[model samples]
Target: MRITNGAGLPAINEAPGAQIAEGPAIVPRSASAVRPAGDATTLRLSHAEMQKLPDVDSERVADIKAALLDGTIVFDASSLAARIARYHGGPQ
Candidate 1:
């Protein structure tokens, strides 16, 4: 169930075809760009935003869990995999 090879990432900077472009790295900042740092930031939680979260259906969840344990639930691995791939911007 685990893919150890998938964990390895190619180092693009050290790759054979990799190129370190030599150009102006730092962009010129405007005079107005330098501003004084503000005071401690205050995080305000919106009640409207909090209320937008969907309420959990405890009974429905329990039924689904029981069905899974009893092997009564119909699960399509390919369909679920496709949905997961689509969600992660992977090939369908």
Candidate 2:
């Protein structure tokens, strides 16, 4: 049955109870799926690539750890927000 709308467009919503027969169900590969040996290749980042990460001063790290131990440490949300904003091109 051809169903048309006010604008003479094919009314897709009119065929509500229509059932279209489909092919066999495709079973997806689970976590235990057998993968090819060479397909699981991972590229190891070099020392230089890892070294490009942000540098943290050892003294500041120790100070933060000390503060955490003494219950005087408070996380600065703005710092993380700024970092995330910088990551997403909001600000640097």
Weakest 10 consecutive residues of candidate 1 by summed lDDT: 36-45
Clashing pairs in 2: none
For candidate 1, the per-residue lDDT at 32 reads 81
Q: Quick one: RMSD of model 1?
A: 14.6
* Cα lDDT of model 1 by residue, 1-92, tens digit: 12244557654345576665667868899988775444222222455566777699788999999998899997889999999999999997
Q: Against the correct fold, how does model 1 do in TM-score?
A: 0.33
- Model 2 scores a C-alpha lDDT of 0.73
Write model 2 residue lDDT over 1-92, tens digit each, in one string: 34567987757655678754566567678976886655544323455576887787888899889998898987789999999999999968
CA lDDT scores, all candidates in order: 0.71, 0.73
Clashing residue pairs in all predictions, respectively, total 0, 0
RMSD of each: 14.6, 13.5
Stretches off by above 4 angstroms in model 1 are 1-54, 76-78, 87-89
